[model samples]
Target chain A: MKFGVVTFPGSNGDYDSYAAVRFAMKEKVEFLWHKSEDLQGCDAVILPGGFAHGDYLRAGAIARFSPIMKHVIKFAKSGGIVIGFCNGFQVLTESGLLPGALLRNNHLRFNSKFIYIRVERTDTPFTGVCRKGEVLKIPIAHGEGNYYNFESDVRKLEDNGQVLFRYADASGNASAAANPNGSINNIAGIVSAEGNVLGMMPHPERAVEDIIGSSDGLKVFESVLNYCISPKPVGRL
Target chain B: MTTTAKTKKVIVYVRLKDGVLDPQGVTIQKALGQMGYPDFVSVRSGKFFELEIDAGASDIDRQINEVCSKLLANPVIERFSVEKI
Candidate 1:
């Protein structure tokens, strides 16, 4: 199947993401520019990370209005596979494609580190390869990476199983230091109501290659390809 | 002859609490520090703004509160209040 990786003006991970998908799944991947209204005959869309629009207004505020995002929204609404990382996650939230918002790091500083994410659920295409409580070491790079939302929203996420990843220590215990930016409920990722749209603060592309030092991210792409290759029920995460 | 006094414009600003990272503000402050001699001790940042709504004394206060909550400030990590000065 053909995978579409969307590129915004300031995208830094478009190539990394494309290479990861192809290497991990041997899938035909294409680059869709932010201005393109069409996704160019692709089955899935990946919104990679970077400082789009220099993150001027808000992290994902400006890019959410990009033309390509319009198509992305349409694509996801029609049961298409959509995954966003870091800034891409910000865009998803800003577009209202997902719930919650990413505020600045609670420590009031930029964070660049490898954070272990304890998988809350792995039934979605994004995490299908892993089981519940599966641990992943993905790198996070952003000042506004703290995930925040209302208490009602948190309860809804818990009830609906929309929450996907939570920051954790090696022990898999949720703590403030492990939480990194003090995300509410230690959230590191989430998905939309339909479960097709997945957004996470960690960069799977950056983790796909062991050369950069980790391959835990490969499972996410692998799972997507696995679903496309075979037919499986998409589950909530 | 006396002219009606021009109504003074009051402005209010809002943003994240002190413990939050303001990346944009940091970048701007760094640029400022790089220009030449650096004497600015600390740089805390927030939004700048103005309001021109015409309403009763109580109504104006209520409208400001509404606007801040609805648009100006994100309730999650921000603390907001208004000033008339």
Candidate 2:
């Protein structure tokens, strides 16, 4: 499976994501710079973490207008799985690829730690490998990760099973201790209406290495691989 | 000899309105009080943007207005003011 990791000017996690894909799936992952409009025939794309554009303006404001973003948006609209992590999530939000704005952390500090996130729903392509109620430990580092959307939108997410994951304790119980950023409704991540594009604040790539601690994130990549092998429809619209 | 060029400074502050709950501001105020700055007053936080644009052909006022309205302010709960300092 060909994976494309988009790199913004300040993107730091694209390399880590490349390494993760190589180690787990043994594939020659491609690096798609934010400026390049050409994707070079990638099956899926990932927007990795880091302070894109030095996080100037807003976290993902400038990066959302990158030339490649137009292609990424179309790719996602065509039923491609465009998963965004950390800063990537911000970009998706800014570009209207995802809903909800990420406000400053409720704690008013940068959070960097492995926190438990329960699989709130698995009906999407990104979370199909994860079982509902399964809790995975993922590290998050960001000041603006508090997700806030209109109450109607939040309810729609819950009703449609678009809320894929929530911060929860290791035992799979959801609570403030598990919710790192005090995101509204404790939402750690969510998917688009079609369940193809997902934007989440947690870093799943960092959790793929066993020696680092728990590799619960492998489940996410594994789910992607399974999706790749599965007979995906021809091309995106 | 060529003359040096200079641009005016623009200050834009975005703050939560009255009656709005600003958890970040509250936390900072609490922390300040805890640090023994008992005299510290209320702290309502917002964004400060310094924009330097080529005011040659474009309308500076229009550009600045677009920047503030479209990007700087969320327009839902936040208010902003821009001044040339």
Candidate 3:
């Protein structure tokens, strides 16, 4: 399946995402400029990490107004697969494609480190390759990765199985020490109610190869690719 | 007939909603307490924006509201108040 990686102004990780797809995964990939209002017939789209639009007013706030986002919004509404990583996740929330908001870290410090995230559910395309409660070592680099939502919305997300990944220890326990950003409920990643879109703070693209450290991040991309190649029936015909 | 449009200033104040955690505010409070200002109860951090728009802009209220909701503040975690002066 072909993948489209968005390149918003100031997006530094677009190349990393493109490289991961083209070289590491050996898949067809294209770069979608922020001003282009086209998807280019790609199967899935990736909004990579970085301070888009210099993260001026707020992270992802200005980037949301990019012309390409209009197409992205429509694509996601039609059940298209979209993954927003780090700053991209902030964009997803700012665009109202995802729920909740990312806030300043509780410690008010920028954290850049390798962390563990336990797969909360393996049903969605993003986490299909992960075993139940499996932990993957990924690196997170952000200052406003703390996720906040109303109590009711949080409960709704939990009930709907929208909570996809949580900060966890090496043993898969959701502990405070494992949560580098102080996100509510230790949430590191989550999906929309329909499970078509995913927003996460961790940078999986950075951990796609064993030479760097671990290849666990590859599972996420592979899962999406496999799903796209062999889609399941949504309902009786 | 001729018409002249005047520029007006709009101020928008944005703050985290009740119960939302404010780490920056907490740190400032800590510093204040350590600096011998223990009587202060609490501190909350917020932001404001000053917008200069033409007074004759169509639907000025609606436009300002849209700006607040779409760009100035995130509705999920923040609440904003806009005032014209």
Worst 10 residues of 1 chain B by lDDT: B1-10
Per-candidate local distance difference test: 0.82, 0.82, 0.91
Candidate 2 residue lDDT tens string, B1-85: 1222455566788776564456778888899999999787888877777765543636878878888867786544467898865
Rank ordering of all candidates by TM-score, starting from the highest: 3, 2, 1
Model 1 residue A220 lDDT score:
82
Question: How would you encode candidate 2's per-residue C-alpha lDDT over A116-230 as one tens digit per residue?
Answer: 8898766555666788799898888888898877778889888877778898888988787778887878899988877788889999989987788678888887777777769
Candidate 2 deviant stretches above 4 angstroms = A231-237, B1-11, B16-23, B31-42, B50-62, B74-85
| Residue A167 in model 3: lDDT | 97
Q: Total backbone clashes of model 1? A: 1
Docking class of 2: acceptable
- Which residue pairs come into collision in candidate 1? A108-B21
Q: Which stretches of candidate 3 lie over 4 Å from their true place?
A: A233-237, B1-5
CA-based DockQ, model 1: 0.19
Superposition error at A40 for model 2 (Å): 1.5
**Best model number under TM-score:** 3
Candidate 1: where is the Cα deviation over 4 Å?
B1-45, B49-85
Worst window of 10 by summed lDDT in candidate 1 chain A: A228-237
Which residue pairs in candidate 3 collide? none
Q: On TM-score, who's better, 1 or 2?
A: 2
TM-score, cand. 3 vs. native:
0.96
